[model samples]
Target: MTEHGRPSAPSLFDHAVEEIRATEFRDDLVVREITAPAGVAPFSLAVAADIRPEVDGVDSPYGTGRFILLHDPDEPSAWGGPWRIVCFAQAPLEPEIGTDALLADVAWSWLVDALDSRAAAYHSASGTATKTLSKGFGSLAEEGDGAQIELRASWTPSGSLSPHIEAWAELVCMLGGLPPGSEGIAVLGSHRSTRG
Candidate 1:
């Protein structure tokens, strides 16, 4: 116990890391924090990643997108919480999928299923899903002219967040938008598909 009375200067980032380690799924994902440098309170947050599947997979040119969670100390009017967990996923899609409503529905399921499967406690989730198609006319290299889908959501972590943390890690893996239970995760079994 230091002068701060609560403990030491472990910082929020350190706490988050310890939380990730104790959650039981940290090894399968890459966890890191992204600090927003221009904000008043220094909007620092962590992300646990599960890369997306590619055409060739092992040698695929681009990576599978991500399901990201964000935490902020400054309470926002909309989220109504000191910390908000945000989720998102972007993956190259066939041109035909650009207009399909299933994209949004499926993306939404990824989050919901993850939460339910992991029995995570959370509330007040809200956000949108967007389909983006690359467009440009320049010699500079750019993302291919393929379609991509992004799903965004924000929520507050409820008490005893161990379940929530496990769910979030699985959610990141799902956001890769690949068939779950592939490489390194098959042994864990596809928990999302077992909903009954």
Candidate 2:
């Protein structure tokens, strides 16, 4: 190599980065690259998105989320491969739904379903789904009560990342109450279950 005396050949990780950049997502989801966290891996990429319906005039988003890709060419033993995908999604929920004991389980299933629908191969998947209920008290009593569901997950991807990214985008849409491939059709309530 002319510079640094290192070979210039692109690595597999470089190709993965290109694939992620070229992938297209549904119009309802606004995605943009963000700074990835330090020390997670030798190579990393991060993206943040908001699930907002263009047809709807609502100023607030139904949900917001982040997707992070980490690659360790050394093949970290715990990752089972060179790549790992980390995801976090949060969406507002009706207070009653958030109080349901099954809410956490349902939220976790959404991610599993999203990856499966895309035929995204992965393993070592693990995560937690949390429901947060907020109630106004004291001087803030006028704000009323509200609730939300948050999903955090990490898994090792087995192949091309394009499908994985698309699946993640769909997961964000699903968390925001939009059905898979729905474009912009707004649903009355959360679409927390798999449609089959």
In terms of lDDT, which candidate is strongest? 2
| All candidates: CA RMSD (Å) | 7.7, 5.5
The digit string of per-residue lDDT tens for model 1 on 1-196 reads 5676763334654575466556654344444444333452233444434442233223112222333334455566665755556555444555455568677887778778878877677778777877765543466234334566667676776555566656655655554434445545542222222101
Model 1 residue runs over 4 Å out of place are 1-16, 24-29, 36-43, 48-77, 134-145, 184-196
lDDT of 2 by residue, 73-111 (tens): 778899998889999888887777779999889888888
Off by over 4 Å in 2: 1-10, 53-60, 187-196
* Worst-scoring 10-residue span by lDDT in model 1: 187-196
Q: What is the C-alpha lDDT of each candidate?
A: 0.53, 0.79
Q: Residue 32 in candidate 1 has what lDDT?
A: 41
Instruction: For residue 24, give model 2's deviation from the true position in Å.
Output: 1.2
Q: Report the backbone clash tally of model 2.
A: 0
